[model samples]
Target: MTNKPMVSIVCTSYNHGDYIAEAIDSFLMQKTNFEFEILIYDDASTDQSPRVIKQYENNYPSLIKPIYQTQNQYSKGVRVEMFNHNRASGKYIAVCEGDDYWTDPYKLQKQVDYMERHPACSMTVHAADRVLSDKKKVLSRVRPEERNAIFSVERVIEGGGDLIATNSMVYSKEKVKVLAPFYLNAVVGDYPLVILAALHGTVDYLDENMSAYRVGVKGSWTERELATSLKRINHYHDMEKMFDEINEYTEYRYNSALEKAKLGYRFSLLLEQGRFREAKHGEYRKIYLELGAKKRVLLEMKRYFPNVTESIRKARWKLIH
Candidate 1:
């Protein structure tokens, strides 16, 4: 057999000292017939994350390759994943952030088998369980709407909200490398990668839950404590910019879906800050006008009766949960 690995597991880390070991251990525990290498990029963490990664590298010299940075690259507008991407020497690439861990030992093997059988599929993603870090509660079990489903580019674009778990994603490295410039300029990483893979070929969704996506972890990007109204607005604007880039690249093939996503984020921001009147006057005015009569009436109620609206919101949340 050749010395080269068949799959390269690329993990990116910052200050995830507490969780980094679990992520690395999960990769090490994966039982696959073919060889795979773990390429971890540490962005000058100020915690014990580097130490934990060093232990793994020392233990598995042949399987684990690590890059320790002296300066924080993300703050300098560098794409850390691209660094990992360039170093990967495998036909397939599997991504698992340092805060998350694979639950199934067969996760990599299963995805590889599926990709091997379906030559037309550029990517394969499995289901994952989302857990809250502090409470150690499973927030929700996320999966595709259908099992063993083949998703087209249009379909993938339409199912916009967390359709594919990043930790559960495995894609063709050859196809991913040829993605348009928009992918490199994207505000967020995973969504654009999914879109690029879909654009190349079909995407497969396996229903098996194989990974754990920890939310609200300290120093993690998805932490709720780090999100403020202003930050949310800025994030939405960045998303809008990414959509514009994608629209230009795809020649407006998925403009309808992109427009819906843009409108959704704008509306969400408006609702978050209780800016109902502003929503009725800006570029989002068309979206406001397009809202169903019942929804429009609800917004009008929110504007006129803020206290009542807050009470109703709490009640609705209580009912849902």
Candidate 2:
């Protein structure tokens, strides 16, 4: 079909040596008649990731184009580089990280065809099954409507529902040109990308599960500690600040920050109520401060008053003894 559309698949790889091959294989497995190209940026991985990527590049010279870096760049910076280096002469662009894989052969085709037909659509994302690293287990599945029946800006701010995991997303290049700046302009990239894309027009939601999202790997951004969470919260705050700087009248910034703040308050409440087996509140409060949320401060202090009073009692008992 000479008239068929072309889509560019953009994948970023780090040190995913254990699962890089599968990631590359997923793209090559697409059985679409339409022309498509794969762009893989290997961010100077330390392990066998570059080697694995090269193997695929050599194997599929026509379909896969690999950009193996000589030095390592962190995920935050690497993704912005992905947008800058990406030159897709296609109507649409798709994304899949090195750890994630497409389970369906028609994943790209299905989304591409839908977006092409619907001119008002700026992007499309499908549900994904979350796969844990150990036992290669499927932990849970998420869809957009699961978090929100209506894809409004408020639901997005609340951070609920079927979000576009890197692998499960396909976007229009025209929309990309407009939205990529907004996404890259922020330290927290993914959410802003979706927000800006949603602003352009309606997003096509595919109810079908399309990809597998892998978690619990070393050096993965998802594997954040308290320090990392604090840093990320700071970055997320910077992103929200940028949102306000650009769109001052838009209340989504406050709503998003408030959502993060509410999460902090809830986690602190969990800790205060002695829910130690499950909840962690140390870092959530850091996010609350980062978001500049004043409303939750009183609630947070109230949650910690009992612990503070207990500590004082223990000190007094020690002195008396």
Q: Tell me, by TM-score, which candidate is best.
A: 1
Where model 2 places Cα greater than 4 Å from the true spot, the runs are: 1-5, 75-85, 146-150, 160-162, 224-229, 232-236, 242-246, 249-321
Q: Candidate 2, which ten residues in sequence have the lowest lDDT sum? A: 223-232
lDDT of 1 by residue, 93-146 (tens): 999999899999999999999999989889999889998763547988878765
Which residue pairs in model 1 clash with each other? none
- Candidate 1: worst-modelled 10 consecutive residues by lDDT: 220-229
Best candidate according to lDDT: 1
User: What lDDT does candidate 1 reach at residue 271?
Assistant: 73
Reference-based TM-score of each model:
0.86, 0.73
Candidate 1 displacement at residue 111 in angstroms = 0.5
lDDT of 2 by residue, 11-95 (tens): 7777888888888788888988788888888778889998888888888888778777776665345554454235666778887
Positional deviation of residue 211's Cα in model 2 after best superposition, in angstroms: 0.6
Q: Could you tally the backbone clashes for each prediction?
A: 0, 3
